[model samples]
Target chain A: MFEKYFVFSPYFWLVLFFFIPLAIIFKISISVSEWGMPPYQDIFLFDNGFKINTTFENYVYIFSDYYYIGSFVNSLILALISTFFCLLIGFPLAFYIATSNIRLRNILLVLVVIPFWSSFLLRVYAWKIILQNNGILNVILLNLGITSEPLQLLYNQYAVIMGIVYTYLPLMILPLYGYLNKFDLNLIEASKDLGLNRFKTFFKVILPLSVPGIVAGSLLVFIPVVGEFIIPEMLGGSDRLYYGKILWEEFFVNRNWPGASALAFSGIIILVLPIVIFQILYSRWSQKNEI
Target chain B: MKSSLIKSTVIFLGLFFLYFPILVLIFYSFNENKRVMVWKGFSLRWYNELFNNEQIIEAFIISIKIAALSATFATILGVMIGYSLVRIRKIPFKSFYIFLSSTPLVLPELILGLSMLLFFISLNNVIGFPSSRGQLTIFISHVTFCIAFVAIIIQARLTDFNKNIEEAAMDLGYNYTKVLYKITLPIILPSIIAGWLLAFTISLDDLVVASFTTGPGANTLPIVVFSKVRLGLSPEVNALSAILMFALIIIGLFYFYFNKKFKH
Candidate 1:
C-alpha cells in the first residue's frame, strides 16, 4: 500500500508536468493559428454547437520553408562536427584516465568533470575573454609576431565549434571513461603478444570493444548540441542559424506560438524521440548488467 | 621513455586545455582596470562592485531560493521514482514510465523550455490561477527536469545497495515503512544528499530554461548575466564568474564526494 504512494506521486507529477506538457506541445502544433491572445485557436469550439479545428499547415510551413529546414541542417552539421572534435580530444583523455591506476582514476575523472559544476554561461564567457582582439590569445599571438594585426575571432562558426567541443567534452569523456574502465587492460597486452603492432591492436581489439562507449558518448554530446543555443549565441556571430536560435526567435522574437510549438514538436520527432527510445532500451540493458 | 613522456604530456595538455580558460577568468577578475581584457594591478575591485550591485545581489538571492526549494521538491519526488523503479514490480507501462523519467535528461533545453512556456500559457488560459509567470513557473519547470537527474542518481545508488539489509529487516518483523525509514533511508541518505546537491547546481546553472520561463522580476542570475553579456562582455560578470564558479565548484565537489562515497 505504501509503495503505491512512491509510484503514484512521481507518476502524477510527470504526467501533469512532463507528459502533458509534451502533449500540449503537440496539441498547439496542430492547432490553427489566429491573430488573438494565446495566438492559436483552441482545439474545441462551441460557437454554433461543437467543432474541431486543427491544421497540418504548421508542419507544412516549417517543412516548406528553407529558413527553418536550413537552420535545422546547420544544427545537425554543427552537432556532428562538435561531436567529432569532442571524440577526437576526449578519446585519448578518457582512455588515458581509465588506464590510470585505480587510485588516480577517480581524482583525474573528478578534475575533468568539475568544470561542469560551474555556470555554463560563465565558461562560455571565459572564451569571449580569450578570443577578444585584446584578449590573452590575441595578445600572445600579436606579441609573438604570428600575425601583424589582431585577428577577429570572437563570433563565427569556428568559435561556436570550439566552444561546443570545450563545453561538451566532459559529457563525451564521462561515458567513454565509464565504458573504457570496465574492459580489461590485459586485452591490450594479449593483442600485443599475438604479434600485433600498436595500431593494429588498437584498431582490432580496443576500438571494436569501445564502440558502445563511443556511441554513448557521442549521443550524449550530439543530442544536446543539436539544440544547443547558448554556445552559439555567445561565441557565434551572425554567420549562421541553428535550430535553437530559430525556435527561440519564432516564439520570443517573432511571436508565433503555434509555429514555435510545431518546431518543438518536430524537434521531438526528429531529434529526441529516437534517442529516447534507444536510451530506454539501453538503460534496460545496463540495469540487467548491473544486476 | 618516449611512451611514458608522451602519456604524461597528453594528460598535462588535456588538463591545461580544461583549466586554462577558467584560470584566465579568475586571473582577470581581480584586475582594477575597467577594461576586462587588459591586465592591471591586482585588487578586489570587481568583487567589491559585485557586492554593491543591487541587481546581481537580488538575482543571486532569488537563484539560491529557487534552487533550494526546487531541489528539495525534486529530491523527494526523485527518491520516490528511484525507489519505485528498483523495488516495485507491478508498474504498468513500465517502459513508458521509464521513458518519461529519462527523456528530460536528453531533450534539448530549448525545446523543453518552449514546451513548458506553452504549457504555462495554456494553463493560465484555462485556469487563470498563476495569473502571470514568475518564480512559481520557474520552480515548477526546475523541479520537473531536476527530478530526472535526481532520479538517475538515486536509481544508481539504490541498485548498488545491499538488498540483504532490507531482507533482514523484514525478517526481523519490521513493516515496510519501518524498514524503509530505519534501514533503506539511512543507507541511501548520502545519495539523497547528493541528488539534492546535483539538483541545486543544475537549477542554479540553468540559463536557457530559466530564460524561457522567466518573467518580470524573475530574472535569474544567468538571465541577468546573459542580458548583460549576450551581445558583448561585462567586466562585473568576469568578477561574478570567478566568485560564482568558485562557489558552484565547491558544491560540485560535495556532490561528487557524497555520491562517490556510497559506491564503496
Candidate 2:
C-alpha cells in the first residue's frame, strides 16, 4: 500500500510523509518559547492552524491540586527508598561476585539474569501471589506458629517496594559488576600492604573508585521508578497514587488529553534535570581524576 | 571465618529472594483449589483449562505473530543502521544517531508510548494509510523500540570485527553489495541471530507500548493477563503464567545447550 502511494507521486510522498512531520515536530518545540502559553494546550487545537500560547496554569494546577501533588511526592519517595534498598542488597552480591574466584561465578550471574528474561508483568504477578493476604508467605508464617492471622502483604507500599527492587536489582548489578570486574587488584594489595585492614582498604580504595558505577546504577534505577505505573497500580492498593498512574488516569480514564500532555511534558523536565546535573558532575570528576 | 559465612549466607538469601516468587508461581499452577493461596493438593486442572480457552489461544497466536513479524522488521532496520554507522565515514551527526538509537533504552516507556500515540494519530489524519490503529500500528511501535536494541548489539559486534576480510573480498573485484552479502554478513550472522532473539523477547514482553498502540481485536497476552489480574486473580491466570515460564525456560535451556555444544 505504501509502495503504491510512493510510486504515484515520488516527491510528494517524500515531502508530505517524512519531511512535513519532522518540520511540524520541530516547529512545535520552537513555538513553545515564543507563544507564552503551554505547548500542550496547542496540541488540543492541532486541527486549527497549529499556533500555540504558553501558560503556567497547568503546572500551577498540578502543584495546587492535592491528588497530583501527593502522587508526585509519593513517586519521588518511593523511587528514593527503592534505590536505597537495591543498593543495600545488590552491593554485597555484586562485591562478592566481583572479588571472588569462585568457579560458579558465571553460573550465578546467569541465575541472576534468568528472572529478568521472564516477562515483567508476570514477575509482578508472581509477587502478587506471594504477598496476598492468604498467599504463600502468610501461609508459611501461620503454619510455623509465628502468626495466628494472615498478614496484609499485597496491595500496599511494602509490596510495591518489593516489586520495584526485585525488578531493578539486575540493572544495578550489571553496571557495578562491570566496574568491579575491571578493578585493579594491586590497589587493594597496596592498601593492605601498608597495614590497612580489609574494611579500611575497601572504604579507602574500592568504594571511592567505584563512585561512577554507583552513580550510573542509581540513575538507571531512579529514573524509571519515578514514572513507574505497573508496579504501583498492581501492588499498591486503591489509596496509593503515583505520577505515572496520574498520567494514565488522565489520558485513558478521564480522557483529558491536554492535562495528560502537560503532566507528561512536566515529568520529562523534572526527571531530566537531576540526571543532566549528575552527568555533568560525573564527567567533571572523571576528567579531574584523569588529569 | 564468621564474616565469610555471613557473606555466603547473604548471597544465598539474595538468590532465594530472586527465585522464591517464581517457584511459588510454578507450584500454584498445579494447585487444585480455586483460591491461589490454599494448596488443595496437586492437579493439572488449570493447565487443562488453559488448553481449552479459545480467547487465550487467540491472544497467544496474536502475540506470536506480532513478535515474529516485528522481530524480523527490527533486525532488517537495525542491520541497515548498524552497517551505515560502522562502515560509512564522514556521516553528519553520527553522535546524534548514536544518541537517537540509545534513547529508547533510557526513555520512560510512557513517554515513548505517548509520543508514538501522538505520532500515529497525526499520521493517520495526514497520510490516511494506517486508517485505523490495530495490528500494523502496534507492530510498527514494537519495531521502532526493538531496532534501537538490535542496532546497539550489532554495532558492538561490528566494532570488534576485523576489517581485513572485507577489504580482501573487495580487493578480489567484488562490489560493495557483494562484499557485504558474501563476507560481512556471514561473519556477523551470530550477532544478528542474537539481536533477533533479543528483539523477539522484548516485543513479546511489552505491555505499555502494546496497550497504547493496540486497537480493537488485537490484545496481546501481557495486556490480557494485566487486565485479568486487575479484576481478580484466577487459577487460569496462574496457568497462563506457568505456560509463559515453561516456554521461556525451554528457550533458555535450548540456548545454553546449543552454546555448550558449539563450544565443544
Candidate 3:
C-alpha cells in the first residue's frame, strides 16, 4: 500500500505538470491564432456546437519561412562550434585531472567545477566586461604591442561562442572526468610496451575507451547550447540570429503564439524526443547487461 | 618529465581560462568608478548601493522564497520517484515513468518554459484557479523541472545503496514504514540534502524559465539581474555578482561535502 503511494504521488505530479504542459504546447501549436487576450482560439469550441477548431497553419508558416529555418541552422552551427571548443579545452583538462593522484584529483576536480556553480548570467556578464573596448584584454594587448588599436570584440558570433564554451566547459569536463577517472591507467604503459607511439596509443586505446564519455559530454553541452538564450542576448550582435532568439521574439515581441508554439513543439520533436527515447532504451539495455 | 610539463601547462591554462573572468568580475566589483571598466581607487560603493536597492532586495527575497519552496517540494516528489524507480517493481508503465521524470533534464529550458507558460494560461482558461501567474506558477515550473535533477541524484545514491540493510530491518520485525524511516531515509539523508541544494541553485540561477513564467510582482533575482546586465553592465550588479558568486560557491562546497560524505 505504501509502495503504491510512493509510485503514484510522483506519477501523478509529473503527469499533471510535466506531461500535460508538453501536451498543451502541441495543442496550442495546432490551434488557430488571432489578436486577443490569450492570443489563440480554443481547440475545442463547445459554444460553436462541437466544432474541432484546429489548423496546421502555424506549422506550415514556420516550415515555409527562411527566417525560422535559418535561425535553427544558425543555432545548430553555434551549438556544434561551442561543443567542439568545449571538447578541445575540456578533454585535456579532464585527462590530466583523472590521471592525477587521488587527493590532488579531488581538489582539482572541485576547482574545475566551482565556477560552474557560480551564477551563469554573471559569468556571461564577466565576458562583457572583459571584451569591452578599454577592457583588460585590450590593455594587455596594447602593452604587448600586438595591436595598434583596440579591436571590437564584444557583441559578435565569436563572443557568443566564447561565452558558451566557457560556461558549458565544466558540463563537458565532468562526464569526461567521470569516465576517465574510472579508466585503468596501466593501459597506457601496456600500449607503450606494445611499441605504440603516444598518438597511436591515444587514438587506439584511450580515445576508443572514452567514446561514451565523449558522447555524454557532447550531448550535455550540445543540447542546451542549441537553445541557449542568455549568452547570445548578453554577448551577441546582429551578425547572427539563433533559434532561441527567434522563439523569444515570436512569442513576446511578435505576439505570434501559435507560431512560437509550433517552433517549440518542433524543437521537442527534432531535438529532445529522440534523445529522451534513446536515453531510456540505453539505460534499459545497460541494466539488462548489468544483470 | 616533458609530458608531465605539457600536462601541467594544459591543466594550468585550463584552470586559468575558467577562472580569469570570475576573478576579473570580482576585481572590478571593487572599482570606485561608476563606469565598470574604468578603474578608479577601490571602494565598496556599489556593494552599499546594492543593499539599499529595494527592487533587487525584493527580487532576492522572492527568488529565495520560490527556490526554497520548490526545492522542498521537488525533493519530496523526487525522493518518491527515485525510491519508486530503484526499489518498487510494480510501477505502471515504467518506461513512461522514466521518460516523464528524466526528459526535463535534457529538454531545453526555452521549450520547457514555453510549454509551462502555455500550460498555465490554458489551465487558467479552463479551471480559473490560478487567475494570474505569479509565485505559484513559477514555483510550479521550478518544481516541475527541478524534480528531474533531484530524482537523478537520489536514484544514483539509492542504486549504489546496499539493499541488505533494509532487508535486514524487515527481517528483524520492523514494518515497511518503520524500516524506511529508520534506515533508508537516514542513510540517504545526505543525498536528499544535496538534491535540495542542487535544486535550489538551479532554481535561483534560472533566468529563461522564470522570464517566461513570471508575472507581475514575481521578478526573480536572475530576471532582475539579467535585465540590468542584458544591454550593458552595472556596477551594482558587479557587486551583487561578487557576493552571490561567493555565497553560491559556499553552497557548492556544502553540496560537495554532503555528496562526498554519502560515498562512505
Candidate 4:
C-alpha cells in the first residue's frame, strides 16, 4: 500500500526533488568524462568511444606533487593538533560541567551552545578581526605595555588552530558531557576510599569509562576539521593551504571537474577510513562491555 | 582544594576565550571612530548606519526568507522520515539507510556545496527546470542537509516515545492518519519545533554552501560580511554582527523561557 502511494502520490515530488537531481548528475558525469565510465570502474561501456581502465593516476598525482602533498600534511597536522587541544581543554570543562551544581548545569550548557546559533562565518570573521595585527588583542597588548609593536597573530598556523578549536570545542564538550553525566560517583568514592589519589582515580576510572565519548567527540571534530575550508582559508591566508582549500581551488578556481572529483573522492576516502575503523573498534568494545 | 581552584580558573579562562571576541564585537559596534581597534568614545553611528545600509538590509531579508522557507520544509520532511522510521517494522537496511541519510551531518560543507553545485548544473542541463540557479537552488540545498539533522534529532526523540497509546487509539477504529494527527503529532510537537529551530539556525548560519550555490545578485548576509572582512574590518560589519548576535540571544532566551513555562 505504501509503495503504491509512494509511486503515485505527491511524495514523489519530494523524492524527485531530492534524489533525481543527484541521479541525473551521476548519469551526466559518466557520459561527459572521456572514460565513458567512472574513473574507478575497470571497463568502458563502448570500445571506441573512450578508454576506461582503472588507474591510480589521481592518487598518484595528489601524493606525488609537492603542493598537494604539502596541503595534505598541513591538513593532518592541523586537525591532529586542534583535536589534541580540544581534548586537553574540553575534558576538564566537560567534567566540571557534568559534576557542577544541578541548577547551573543547564545554564552552562546553554551558554556553550548559544554561540553555535550565530553565523559560523561571522564567528570566524570575528576571530580574524581579533587576531589581526592591528586588531583588539594587539591594541590591548599595546595599552598594557606588553609589546613595543603589534604582534603578528593573524594569517598564521596558530590562528588557524585557534579558529578550529574555537568552533569545534563544543563538539568535544557535548559528548564528553554525555559520558561524564552517566559516571557513577560511587566508583570514584570507592577508589578514594581504597587509598588511590584523586588524580589517579580520575585517570584510571573516569577516563576509562568515558573512552567511548572521547572517541566519538574526537572523530566528530577531526573528520570535519580534515575537510574544513573556511577557517583555514580566512585565518591561514594565501600563503598557507590545506586539502580543503586545495579541493576548493580545483573546483572553483581551476574548474577542473575531473580533478576536483578525484580529489574529493580520495579526500573522503582518506578521511573516512580512520573513522570507519574507529567505529568498528568502538562497536566491538561496546559489545564486549555489554556482555 | 588547590586542584579545585585550578579547575575553576581553567573553566573561567575557557569562558573568557569563548566570549571575548563577541564582547569585543559588541563594544566596537558602539565605537565612535571608524578605526575598529582603537578605543573611541561610545556612539551608535555604526548601528544607525547598519540599519540604513541597503545591501546589509536586503541581504538580511533574503537570508530570513530562505531560512524560514527551508526550515519549514525541512522540518515537515524530517518529522515524516522520523515518524516512518520509528513506526515501521521489518524495514530492510534501516541502519544503512539511516547512516546514508545522516552522512550529510558529518560531510564537510565545502564538499557538500561543491557536489550540490555540480548536481544543480547537471540538473539544469538535463531537466531544464529551475532554468537559472539562485534563491530556489540555495533553498533546496539548505533543506537537503538541514532535513538530515532535523531527522536525527527527531528520530532520537521518537525512539524513546511510547507507542501503546497510539496502538490503543488505532484499536478503537481510528485510521492511521487520524491516529497520527490526533495522538502522535501532539506528543512529538516539541521535537518538531526543536527540529525546525535547528534547521533554521543551520540555514541561517550557512555560508560555504550558500556561497557555492548562490548566484549573482543573491548574496546572503554572511557572504557580504565575508567579502567586507576580506577587504578590512569595518565598524558597519561589527554593527551588523552585534545586531545578529543580539537577535540570536533574544531568540535563545525566548526559547528557554517558553520551554520552561510550557513544561508543566
Candidate 5:
C-alpha cells in the first residue's frame, strides 16, 4: 500500500511538472503565431465548428533561415573544439592523478573539483577580468616581451572557447578520472615488457580502456557547451553567434514564441532525445545482463 | 625521475589553468581603485560597499530562501524516487519513469527554462493559477531540475549499501515502514544531507532558469550580479564574488564530507 504512495507521488510530480512542460513546448511549437497577448494562437479552437489550429511554418522558418542554422553550426563547432581541448588537457591530468599515491590521489581529485564548486557565472566573469586589455594576462605578456602592445583578448570566439574550456574542464576531468582510476597500472607495464613503446602502449592498452571515460566526459562538456549562454554572453564577440543566444533572442527580442519553441523543440529532438533513448536502451540491456 | 617531472608539470599547468581566473578575481576584490582593472592599492572598500548595497542583500536572501526550500522539497521527492527505483519492482512503465527522472540531468538549461516558462504561461491561460511568475514559479522550476540531482546521489548511496540490513530488520519484529525508518534512512542519512547540499548549491547558482522564471522583486543573486556586470564590471560585484565563492566552497567541502563519510 505504502509502496504505491512512494511510486505514484514522484511519478505524478514528474508527469505534472517535468513531462507536461516538455509536451507544452511541442504543442506551442506546432501552433500558429499571432500578434496577441500570449503571442501564439491556441492549438484548439472552440469558436468555429470544432477545429484544430496548427502549422509547421515555425519549423520551416527555423530550418530555412541561415541565421538560425549558422548559429547552431557555430555552437556545434564551439562544443567540438572545447571538448577536444578539455580532453587534451584533462586526459593527462586525470591519468597522472589516477597514478599518484593513494593519499595524494584523493587530495588531487578534491583540488581539481574545488574550483568547480565556485560560482560558475563568477568564474566566467573572472575570465572577463583576466582577458581585459589591462588585465593580468596582458601585463604578463607585455613584461615578458611576448608582445609590445596589450592583445585584445576579450570578447571573441577565442575568448569564448577559453572561458568554456576553463569552466567545463572540471566536468571532463572528474569523469575521466573515475574511469582512469579504475585502470590497472600493470597493463602498461605488461605492454612495455612486450616491447611496446609509450605511444603504442597508450593507443593499444590505455586509450582503448579509457574510451568510456572519454565518451562520458566529452558528452558532459559538449552538450552543455552547445547550449551555453553565459560564457559567450560575457566573453564572446559579434565575430560569432551561437544557438543559445539565438534562442534567447527569438523569444525575448523577436517576441516570436513559436519560433523559439520550434528551436527549443528541435534542440530537444536532435540533441537530447537520441541520447536519452540510447541511455534507456543501454540501461535495459545492462539490467538484463545483470539478471 | 623524468616521468615524475613530466607528471608534476602537467598537473601544475592544469591546476594553474583552472585556478588562475579565480585568483585574479580574489586579488582584485581588494583594489582601492574605482576602476576595477586599475590596481592603485589594496583596500577593503568594495567589500564594504557590497554589504551596504540593498539590492545585493535582498537578492541574496531571496536566493537562499528559494534554494533552501527547493532543496528540501527535491530531497523528499528524490528520496522517494530513488527508493522506488532501487527497492520497488512493481513500477508501472518503468522505462517512462526512468525517462522522466533522468532526462533533466542531460537537458540543457536553456531548453528546460524555455519549456518551463511556456508551461507556466499555458497553465495560467487554462487554469488561471500562478497568475504571474515570481518566487513561487522559480521555486517550482528549481525543485523540478534539482530532483534529478538529489535522486542520482541517493540512488548511488542506496545501491552501494548492503540491503541485508533492511531484510534483517524486517525479519526481526519490525514492520516494513519500521525497518525503513530505523535501518534504511539512518544508513543513507549522510547521502540525504549531501544530496540536499548539492541541490541547494545548484538552485542558488542557477542563472538561466531563474532568469526565465523570475519576475519583479524576485531577482536572484545571479540575476542581480549578472545585471551589474553585464555591460561592464563592478567592484562591488568583485567583492560579492570573493565572499560567495568562499561560502560555496565551504558548502561543497561539507557535501564531500557527508558524501564520503559513509562510503566505506
Candidate 6:
C-alpha cells in the first residue's frame, strides 16, 4: 500500500504539472491570436452556441518571417562553433584526467566539475568583468605592449561564444570523462605494440571507443547552447540575435503570447521532440545491453 | 617524460581557463575603486554595500526560501520516482514515466518557462486558482524541473548498490514500508542529500524560468542580479558573486563528499 502511494503521488504530480504543461503549450500554439488582454483567444468558447476555434497562423507567421528564421540559424551556428571549441579544449583535459593515477583522477575530475556548482549567471557575469575595456586582460595586453589600446571585447558574438565555451566546458568534460574513465589504458599499449603510429593508434582505438562520450558531450553542450539566452544577452552585442533572444522578445518584450507559444512549440518539434524519442530508444537499447 | 610534461601542461592550462574568471571576480570584490575595472588598494567597501543593499538582501532571502522548499519537495518526489524506476517494475505507462521525469533535464529553460507560464494562465482561466503568479508558481516550477535532477542521482546510486540488502530485510519479515524506511533509504541517504544539494543550487541559479513565472515581489537573487548586471557590471554584484560562488562551491564539495561518487 505504501509503495503504491509512493509511485502514484509523484506520478500524478508529474502528469499534472509536467505533461499537462507541455500539452498546454501545444494547445496554445495552435490557438488563434487577437488583440486583447491575454493576446490570444481561448480555444474553447461557448456563447450563443458552442464553438471551438484554433489556427496555425502563429506557426505560419514564424516560418514566413526572415527575422525569426535567421535568429534560429544564428543560434545553430553559435552552438556548432561553441561545441567544436568545447570539444577541442575539453577532450584533452578529460583524456589527461581520465589517464591519471586513480586517486589523482578523482581529485582532478572533481576540480573540473566543481565550477558548475557556482551560479551560472555569476560565471557569465565574471566574463563581463574580465572582458571590460580597462579590464585585467586588456591591462595585461597594454603592459605587454600587445596592443596600443583596449580592443572592444565584451558585447559581441565572439564574447558570447567565449562565455559559452568557458561555462559549458565542464558539461562537455564530465560526460567525456565518464566514458573515457571506463576504457583500459592498456588499449593504447596494445595498439602501439601492433606497430601502429601514435596518430593511427589513436584513430584506430581510443577514438572509436570514445565515440559515445563525444556524442553525449556534444548533445549536452549543443542542445542547451542553441537555446541559451543569458550568455548572448549579457555578453553579446546587437550584431547577432539568437533563438533564445527572439523567443524572449516575443513573450516579454513584445507580449505576444500565442506567437511565443508557437515559437516554443516549434522549438520542441524541431529541436527537442526528436531527441526525446531518440533518447527513449537509446535507453531501451542500453537497458537491453545491460540485461 | 615528454608526454607527461605535455599532459601536465594541458591540465594546468585547462584549469587556468576554468578558474581565471572566478579568481578575477573574487579579487575585484575587495577593490576600493568605484570604477570596477580599475584596481586599487584592497578594501571591503563593496562587501559592506552588498550587506546593506535591501534589494539584494530581500532577493537573497526569497531565493533561499524557494530553493530550500523546492529542494525538499523535489527530493521526496524524486526519491519516489527513482525508487519506482529501479525497484518497482509494474509501473503503468513506464515509457511515459521515463519521458516525464527525464525530459526536463534536456529541455531548454526558455521553452520550459513558457510552457509553465501558459499552463498557469490556462489553469487560472479555467479553474480560477493560482489567481496570481508568485512564490507558489516559481516553487512549483522549480520542483518540476528539479525532480529530474534528484531522480537521476538517486537512480544511479540505487542501481550501483546490491539489492540483496533489501531482500535480506524482507526475508527478516520487515514490511515494504519498514524496509524502505529502515534499510533502503538509509543506504541511499548520502545520494539523497547529494540530490537535494544539486536541486537547491539549480533552483537558486535559475533566472530564465523564474523570470517567466515571477510576479510582483518574487524577484529571485538571480533575477535581481541579472537585471543589475545585464546593462553593465556592478561592484555590489561583484561582492555578491564572490560570496555566492564560494558558498555554492563549498556545497558542491559537500555533495561530492556525501555522495562519495568522486572516489575511485
CA lDDT, candidate 1, residue A162: 89
How does model 6 do on interface RMSD, in angstroms? 0.8
- Supply candidate 3's per-residue lDDT for B180: 86
Give stretches of model 4 more than 4 Å off.
A1-57, A143-145, A273-291, B1-4, B254-264
For residues A116-156, write the lDDT of model 1, one tens digit per residue. Answer: 88888899989988999888988899999999899999899
* Chain A TM-score from candidate 4: 0.81
> What CAPRI-style quality would you assign to candidate 6?
high
How does chain A of candidate 5 score by TM-score against the true chain A? 0.99
Model 4 score (lDDT): 0.76
Candidate 5 lDDT over A1-291, as tens digits, reads 778888998899899989999999999999999998899998889997889999999999999999999999999999999999999999999999999999899888888998888999999999999999999999999999999999999999999999999999999999999999999999999999999999999999999999999999999999999999998999999999999999999999999999999999999888888889998899789878988
Give per-residue lDDT, candidate 4, residue B220: 83
For model 3, what is the error of residue B200's alpha carbon versus the real structure, in angstroms, after optimal superposition?
Answer: 0.7
Error of 1 at B185 (Å): 1.0
* Interface RMSD measured for model 1: 0.8
Determine the TM-score of chain B of model 4: 0.92
Residue-by-residue lDDT tens digits, candidate 2, B1-264: 997898789789989988888888888999999887788999999999999988888888999999999999878777766776567654445444444455566657786676566667767766776767878878978887887788877777777688998999888998877887888888788778777877888899899888888888899888888888874677998988887977876655544443233222
CAPRI quality level assigned to candidate 2 from its DockQ score:
acceptable
Ranking according to DockQ, highest score first: 3, 1, 6, 5, 4, 2
- What would the per-residue lDDT of candidate 3 be over residues A1-291, giving only the tens digit for each residue? 789989999899999999999999998899999989889998889995899999999999999999999999999999999999999999999999999998999999999999999999999999999999999999999889999999899999999999999999999999999999999999999999999999999999999999999999999999999898899999999999999999999999999989999999999898998898898898789879988
Q: Pick the candidate with the highest lDDT.
A: 3
Estimate how well candidate 6 is docked, as a DockQ score: 0.86
Candidate 2 residue spans exceeding 4 A from truth: A1-56, A63-66, A272-291, B1-4, B168-175, B252-264
Q: Is the docking of candidate 4 incorrect, acceptable, medium or high quality?
A: acceptable
Q: What is candidate 5's CA lDDT for residue A158? A: 99
- Tens-digit lDDT string for candidate 4 (B55-116): 99999889999999999988877776676556655444444445445556777777678777
Identify the leading candidate in terms of DockQ. Answer: 3
Best of the two (1, 5) by DockQ: 1
How many residue pairs of model 2 clash at the backbone?
6
State the displacement of the C-alpha of residue B96, model 6, in Å, after optimal TM-score superposition.
Answer: 0.6
Question: Residue pairs in steric clash, candidate 4?
Answer: none
